[model samples]
Target chain A: EAGVAQSPRYKIIEKRQSVAFWCNPISGHATLYWYQQILGQGPKLLIQFQNNGVVDDSQLPKDRFSAERLKGVDSTLKIQPAKLEDSAVYLCASSRSGLGDSPLHFGNGTRLTVT
Target chain B: GESVGLHLPTLSVQEGDNSIINCAYSNSASDYFIWYKQESGKGPQFIIDIRSNMDKRQGQRVTVLLNKTVKHLSLQIAATQPGDSAVYFCAEKSRDSNYQLIWGAGTKLIIKP
Candidate 1:
């Protein structure tokens, strides 16, 4: 089966600029997740979508980070007015279902660098 | 604010030796735990998982031991190889977290030839 796919393997932008990352989940997966990983750290969940409806966004920095999974298959994560601290890898993941013990499949991720 | 953490940030093991990585989680309610391996320039890949009901589970070359009483989880890799060099992460899913998995800071595994 095809794994989750992400676009723009790497990105570089100045602080205060805007950037967006795209992701395509595996076929038939019903749940999508966005995560931010800082250097030498684990991935932090930014948002979660269950078939286009948001299931969680408690950890997302709403002021600067936004994500949407329209049509329940593809997702886009955007960072507006990107701060120097926003430089990190943005990852996208999907699972067979949002319930139960299903494992998640992840994409390589978009490495964003803010200068 | 529950969190997961590892005792070591990095571990170096000679090829063909066994490796064990330890993790401690603060959420007692978490019942499901998973181990992930992430190579450089790639995303995390699921390695093995264990539930609170089971104390241990084994995969082809990996083992996951969960100690619910102490909130500790360990991943053991047998006959470590160069391909095993990567960052390992532990994540937990609490019954009340709406299926969200809480991740811990990863441990870098280095394989010595």
Candidate 2:
């Protein structure tokens, strides 16, 4: 019954500095996702993982952004040399199945601010 | 005149009144739709969902209506309460099995006593 868990609810860093956010998905969920939500905009998918393997990461900024789901249970998204454009909230979610009627359970999210 | 955006960033409605939130999607292939509620300082929470097959789906006091022809989707909250106040967003899923859910800019709802 526990919801998705994320760490460091708030973070502030200077531009070019490195930062990372973490997520722990719901138990037994097969699908995990990381999204970037800007103020006044909908969330944009950054990367997706299915049991420690990647499913999609087309939108991810390969130059700086990277994500990993090592054990298939927890994930970490990192942005090296962070930029002002990366100040949006980072959200991690999970679903029982990758398709069908399953709804995503999200964590509180980490709010990153780059100066 | 319909900008797929509200004239104001926030809306205040009296309790017990009906609340309607609207969204416009650009992709015609977006066949699956959902509505999510996000409280202040928290991630979004799922409210209701509807597919291209059906025009409407009801859950508790919430209703989701999809108009594929106009590329519009709306969420209706009956007898709205203070607890219902939050940012509402509508998401669309492509027909492909990529599991990608595209989203709309959020609309913030404010409830008054």
Candidate 3:
């Protein structure tokens, strides 16, 4: 029962540069979500994946952000041409089931700092 | 359209004292609510949850009270500690599995030793 795992705990890049974050969810978990947490704000849902299928990504900026969960085990969120505003913690969470008080297990998150 | 938000942006409490954080929600359609605690450099961790049908739910050292009639939620911690020092957020969602969450702005809790 390991927790959700994420890569590159910290990242620093320049604005307009491309950056990508990876997430490996808990075993047997079907729902995976990517959220952006700006300083002093709650995490905003970017995209949600239910076993390789996109459930909701309405908040994802189609022009600059994209994510994929191939085969439904791991996921990657990419932010291209990153802007200063795009610099925030990218959190990856997973749940045992899709609904209820099942609770979302989160990783330490990748803190992206765009200069 | 519901906006989930906290009454305060930050709270400071002494160790061994109880802590009560408040939240106000605008969406009447939301039937589920949850409270999350987030520490620095980490993601939110679930503390407690309550459904609209139920007014209160209790957990170890924690309790969540839901007042759907007034669209409010509160998290009560019996004995606040240094470990409890983190930002708290209240999230609301519908019964449907696909419905997304509406999260509050969050309240930063500071514990005094």
- For model 3, the docking class works out as medium
* RMSD list, candidates in order: 1.2, 2.8, 1.5
Which one wins by DockQ: 1 or 2?
Answer: 1
Candidate 3 per-residue lDDT, tens place, A6-75, comes to 9889999999999999999999999999999999998899998999999899899989999999999999
Task: State each candidate's chain A TM-score.
Answer: 0.98, 0.97, 0.97
Best candidate according to TM-score: 1
Instruction: For model 3, state the Cα shift of residue B14 in Å.
Output: 1.5
Q: State the displacement of the C-alpha of residue B5, model 1, in Å, after optimal TM-score superposition.
A: 1.4
C-alpha TM-score for every candidate? 0.96, 0.90, 0.95
User: lDDT per residue, candidate 1, B46-103, as tens digits?
Assistant: 9999888899999999999999889899999999999999999999887688768888
Give one clash count per candidate, in the order shown: 0, 0, 0
On the 0 to 100 scale, the lDDT of residue B101 in model 3 is 72
**lDDT ranking from best candidate downward:** 1, 3, 2
Q: How large a fraction of the reference contact set does each model reproduce? A: 0.72, 0.68, 0.60
- Per-residue lDDT value at A85 in model 1: 94
DockQ of each: 0.77, 0.64, 0.65
Tell me what TM-score chain A of model 2 achieves: 0.97
